[model samples]
Target: KRYSSEKSHIQGTSKLALGIFDGMKKIHGMGARERLLLQIAVLLHDCGKYISMEKVAECSYNIIMSTEIIGLSNWEREVIADVVLYNTRDFDTFEIMKQRDGMDKRTYLLVAKLVAILRLANAMDRSHYQKIQGLRVVLRDTELQVILDSARDLTLEMGLLRRQSEFFKEIYGIYPVLKRKRNA
Candidate 1:
């Protein structure tokens, strides 16, 4: 049952990532390589949850640092781990920027961008039960809109939408407005 739940959660996250990626591409014209990195960031954003809840982010970093996931070099793993760790709301961007000062500017920017998207995607699936049926991303001149389709009660959905919007605004420098898809 746990495995099944995890699988469903992963699938939901993937869907959210796809929507966010598509919106990002349209909004910022991201290239293939950037898109790939963003996808990887999204996939592994919550891997830390496998460890204890208190230190899930730290555990995720440790896992990535210690294990060799295929197609990701050690340096790449480090970047991903850093992005994951920094995605937590408790950490401020200034702090993360300070830690990243020694690294290449391009790498820091890339990790920051991916982390922002991953954070939003993770928040969109807060239920961990695939309750969100689908998502639509709309790109406006000054803001991004995420329309969530769900059949369940609104409390969890609203909470996730609000959290995701916060990350979206912080990362993209654009306002994020979330609205439910009302049945006609």
Candidate 2:
């Protein structure tokens, strides 16, 4: 189930997004449609890699921005593209904000929240091994805890999540704690 090689990445990513989105909604002031867009962005996050690994992030952004999604408006597509642009690396969030064309605080937060969740969700399946079987997310006052159910060691996934968690923390104002457990 390598993300770079197959369709399973979409399913895995959607699963990761659902858990993260569920936790995020309780902590952020976002609408249901914005949350659903986050889920769609997760599934479409890496479509660029399938086209060319050389510049996957850039390609994915372009593909998403250009594609006419069945249920999404142009603005919705832009939001998804913006979220995908930062999926693989760190970017200046300020620059991202300026591109929103005078979005209100809540809409800005919605976009940021989508990007943050997408980052963590993608990292949850890092190494492209798809070892994670389930995820439980708990948002506390000071930190966000993600409990992962897996059959094997999750060292890679944890490390990636930690790296990506910085953005999550920046957006949501909570440190991220990722752990693996054998039993539910």
Candidate 3:
């Protein structure tokens, strides 16, 4: 499904997503399966944007739900779809849980983690320029600081991340701080 210049966008988002996951995995104790799921979800998170911009995330959720990818199992497809749905915007996690049914607490928790990671990672690539090269994440008691290694000014990313980070903060209980990598 991922190919060409579009593939690079996937690649860029994947890099950021994995970086964020890796940055937090130890602190959060993320399992390998969930990490792989996060990687797959990020890779395909934007596939629907190509078809319609107005309903990009919803479209992405529809596409992933209907189409079966090679490596993803049926439930994995469902999980990815949920991730795609939440990654598209700053949706309130509590509000979402209230609206949906049949999801147990564990599923809700996993979705929360996936969406938190995807939200911040997707927000970093908001301009689609992939201006962010790499990053280092340091977690304090209740804050996650992401120091980006980028050549371009991150005004756009910082602004967007701030807007989109509330969901992440709410779910993870950690305020996310985005900034440039300081001189060594």
Candidate 4:
């Protein structure tokens, strides 16, 4: 609340991310704890925009890492920070490996997964108009489909999602395809 003024976008992104997270839970071995972390990350991912639009990702990462959220350890905070930092920025494998000092391979993978989900959610709300009325996740053997129900045009969202989908595929080994349908 203190850092974010646009509540709807944050809330909508969180909802979309949770929906995606739940849908991918079984496939990725993420459980309740990861869900909580993802929710926290999504909720605060855009807070950096409060300080600087040009450096939202970095500002957001610093804010998240500096603040103390009870029940979340330092490592967990780092996970959330990384999720926020890379939510919009281009990802670098070597840079991430060097920055994460004590993060094990499994935890690093978890961060990547969460970042992938958050990136998709952010792109869905890129315009801050919340055009997505409903989100449905369907997993196939080779592709993960995100069916969006909305009456509004989504050309911008679809284009951003196409750009973000590559990271999702890199992390999950399954391509994410966005499908839009008219609302009933």
Candidate 5:
């Protein structure tokens, strides 16, 4: 059933990606090129799902590292794979950012940024149903509130917001609270 689903219907990841992009733009002032790159990362974050759930991360990594989809360069494909692998909960951002004894700083920072955005977007769609209809941001002096509007009850939505808000907090240093519109 999952494989047969329409691309539009399977858009939870993209929606959340856009939300993160919007958040980054508003809070961190990310420019057009940066936003475009982040958007690409977000769009391809779930391409792994097409392979298998068990070790889907590894599958995605292999596919990105091997494929020439959309004519992306070898380095660009490597960046995609790195982002997918590091998006896991076990990976440490600081350790990755260190550049080790010989790793490249440019690659480390680039992958870190991609993983950060992917983490937030993946959390937003905890249900993987694309249930969230839209998201809005209200920036306060000390807090940033993200309002999520859904077509149905959002018991799962609230939980996702809690988990995903960590990324927002880390990126912007602003408190994030999720609010749903009351039934009228």
Candidate 6:
């Protein structure tokens, strides 16, 4: 609330992301620590938009690194910051990330996974309208089908989801498909 002008978007996106993380926890091999980082990253992801919309990712990274969030070690903060940093930017491959400073292989992969989830959640609320009333995420074979329950038109959200799905597929080996439930 202090940094984000679009509180609904932040809240909605956080809800969606946490839900996704929870649903995929077993398959994704992410536990409580990753979930905590994901939550914090989603919360502060757009805080940089408070400074510059065009450079939100960079600005958010700077802001998060500068702030001393309690209970988080410097490394944990870096994980969250990088997650926010890559929210809009295309993530580097694992080898490219290995050459970067600060994060180890485990942490780097964690950041990438969180970034993937955050990007998809952010896309679901791109209009900041919270059009999706409910959703059920299911991993079926090679697809992560997000069955949405909403009466509103979702062309924008669906299109953005399609665009974001590639990264998700690259990270998880499962394509994300958004399907509107017929009766809902």
Q: Which scores better on lDDT, 2 or 4?
A: 4
lDDT by residue for model 3 over 1-184, one digit each (tens)?
5422277677888899888888897566678888899998888787777778788788888888888788768877777888888886655455566567456567777877888898888889878888988899988888899999998878888998998778788778789998788761
Best by TM-score: 6
TM per model?
0.82, 0.87, 0.88, 0.93, 0.75, 0.95
Candidate 2 colliding pairs: none
Model with the higher TM-score, candidate 2 or 5: 2
CA lDDT for candidate 4: 0.88
Off by over 4 Å in 4: 94-96, 182-184
Candidate 5 structure lDDT: 0.65
Q: How much is the lDDT of residue 121 in candidate 3? A: 86
Clashes of each: 0, 0, 0, 0, 0, 0
User: After superposing candidate 6, which stretches have Cα over 4 Å from the reference?
Assistant: none
Order of quality (lDDT): 6, 4, 3, 2, 1, 5
Q: Write the residue-wise lDDT of candidate 1 on 55-127 in tens digits.
A: 7778777776777878877767777777777767454455556675456666666776777777777777776
**Between the candidate structures 2 and 6, which one is better when assessed by TM-score?**
6
Q: Quote model 3's TM-score.
A: 0.88
| Candidate 5 residue runs with Cα over 4 Å from true position | 1-10, 94-103, 182-184
lDDT of 2 by residue, 1-184 (tens): 2236357777887898888778767777776887788887787778788778888888888888777889898888888887787777565555456675554565566677788888888888777777888888887789888888888877888888878877888888998898777464
| lDDT against the true structure, each candidate | 0.70, 0.78, 0.80, 0.88, 0.65, 0.89
Ten contiguous residues with the weakest lDDT in model 3: 1-10
- As a TM-score, model 6 comes out at 0.95
Clashing pairs in 3: none
TM accuracy, model 4: 0.93
Preferred candidate (TM-score higher): 1 or 4: 4
How far residue 98's Cα lies from its native spot in candidate 4, in Å, is: 3.5
Worst 10 residues of 1 by lDDT: 1-10
